[model samples]
Target: MSKLLNDDVKEMLTNILKDMVDEVYVKVYVDTLTCETCTETHQLMDEISELSDKIHYDLVETHGDKTVGDKYGITMYPTMVVLDKNQEDKGIRFNGIPAGHEINSLLAALVDMSGKPLDLDDATIEAIKAIDTETNIKVFITLSCPHCPGAVTKAHRIAMLNPYVKAEMVEAQTFHEFSAKYNVSSVPKIVINDTHDFVGNQPMEVFLDTIREAA
Candidate 1:
């Protein structure tokens, strides 16, 4: 396959990954039969894994290996799960191709999984830690939306800090069924536990408050 990431991007990724102190595993679940961008997603992950020795990835066919997909609760194509050194699922999921603005979200997830402390505010961290119940956050987005990255990063960082939370970034265009089910009309639409949902780019406190109320 041709390079999905350019030379400049590769160099940038190398610099960004230099801060990684621990191993980060990327598990990519792909379905070639139904997903149009599965090939590109695989190639993109392959290019990224080459940028750093700390990064490794496994490619699993969603239909061919249903057990792994079921374990991760993967229902969409080209889903990527970023795991920690122990191969623990930190609830960081990319439900479609992590290109365009969403690339930043993917990078941030990798860095967090490498045991680096996130730059979130202490108040936000405390708020997330106070939650006692398991929270599942799903942020629906499109690759073209500039504001979606902030939403995704906020959710992923919260999940990184708190064990009770699992956050996923679902590409709206790729998962039309989910988009319809969630009544998504714009980017950065956040759904908590498949019940409470809201739209727009929300602040960290607002996100925590929403989760607290939902839980």
Candidate 2:
């Protein structure tokens, strides 16, 4: 089969990952029997791992490795769990194929897992650090959406900063049931704790305030 990422893309990834200070392991959970994109997602992650020593990946079959899947709360195929250098799962999840603009979100996740600080304002970071209540954030997105990455990155950063936050980037097309349930007609729909939700990309301060209010 052909490579998932081209030479230029590989080179770009290499450069971006070269500054990584810690190791990042991407654990991909897949159910080969039901997932059409499992092979492609595996191949893509494998090629990405080759770009940097700091990056590595493991493919876990959902049925065959139920314990591991269960440990990560992976109920869907093509779910990526980004672990920090110590192999700690901070609840950074990606449900569905990370292609197109979502690829940028994938890269940002790697950077975050590598212990690199997010580029948010100091005040924003402090506010996130102050969040003591558990917050589960799901940002529904489609691969083709140009504006999806920004929202995904922000949510992931929030998860990285606060231990109370668990963020997921859900591909709406792959998980149609969730899209229907949440009424996600548009992309980048932010769902917080299944109680509060909103559509479109929100500013960092506004997003933080929203979570605080929901909590």
Candidate 3:
């Protein structure tokens, strides 16, 4: 029982949750509080609960009379499922501590797709004009695939840092038919405006040069 509510771990979680913004939905699951792992899991949940009002977590224990785990097909000790506001699963699953950047990226993607209009500031307008660009690169990838993140990151960085280039990360697993139509057998396949195609990873500098040429 001593491990069930570890003050030190709980405090750390509190600090992490405090940094959350208005657009994050975090769900934590704790199954079976008999083992050390389960105890630590509860501690983390305590931290998450104290983090922010937006952070929602549900605690589950196999020893207790609860069916949360069964509903979600969770037979593991700790599982986290992040869902968008529409209650749609973004397919991001975590078995351990997730990186802040990864979590923030998911939140940003959800916000962008939630019918929220993006207002372009004057700086954005200036940047767009400066690039004088013309090209859209659609990258097919899966959210949970480790390799897919790096590829999407490279493509996204190029788009943000260069106005002339635009990139989109399409969910390949969810859109298997589209992936087959595009002949995407890999995680980070790039299609230049549906005309040119390439596979595998490329460094940031190389990606910039390639996008420039495409534009």
Candidate 4:
């Protein structure tokens, strides 16, 4: 098969990845029987890891190994749980292939998880920390959508800041059944706790407001 990332894109990603400060450990769960993009996802991780020494990735065959899956509560195929230098699952995850424009989220995660923190005001950071309720954010997206990456990145940023919250980027086209369950017709649909949801690349305040309103 041809390489998932061509040389030009690889060079661009390599240059962009030079911003990483520390190392990132990405645990990729592969499901061969059902996931169509599993091969591409694995290849993407390999290509990405090769680009930066600060980034590291390993594959876990879900059918055989259940250690990481059992700990992280991940059941879906082609899921990637990203960890920082601490190697802890701070709920930084992707439920599908982060391709096309969605690669922005992956790149952001790589940088942030490595060392950089989210650029938010002190008050906003405190507000995110003060939220005690457990929240599950699922940002449904498609690979081609231009606006979806921002939404996914916002969700993940919140998750990274708050231990009580966990976010996942669900690729709508690949996981059609899951998207249909949420009635996801749009590209960037932000669903919280299977209840509160809104569409588009809403601002950080709006995301906080919706999360606060989630039951």
**Highest-lDDT candidate:** 4
Candidate 1 per-residue C-alpha lDDT over 106-147 given as tens digits, one digit per residue, 9 for 90 to 100: 888888789888887787778888888999999999999999
TM-score attained by model 2: 0.95
Segments of candidate 4 deviating more than 4 angstroms: 64-68
In model 4, residue pairs whose N, Cα or C atoms come closer than 3 Å (at least 3 residues apart or on different chains), thus clashing, are: none
Please give the lDDT score for candidate 3. 0.52
Instruction: Indicate whether candidate 1 or candidate 4 has the larger lDDT.
Output: 4
Query: Which regions of candidate 3 fall more than 4 Å away from where they truly are?
Result: 1-131
lDDT of each: 0.88, 0.88, 0.52, 0.89
Candidate 3, after superposition: displacement of residue 70 in Å? Answer: 39
Candidate 3: which pairs clash? 32-62
lDDT of 4 by residue, 1-215 (tens): 78888999999998889989999999999877667888889998998899999998889877645465887888787999999887988898899999999998999999988878677889888888887999999999999999999998888888888899999999999889989999999879999999999999998898999988994
Q: Please, what are the lDDT tens digits per residue for candidate 3 over residues 1-215?
A: 44432578557555544544444454555555433345554565555445456655555556753576665444344555454455444433443322332333333333332323333456543544455556666667655556655665555444544445555555665446667989998766877767777776665545555555666
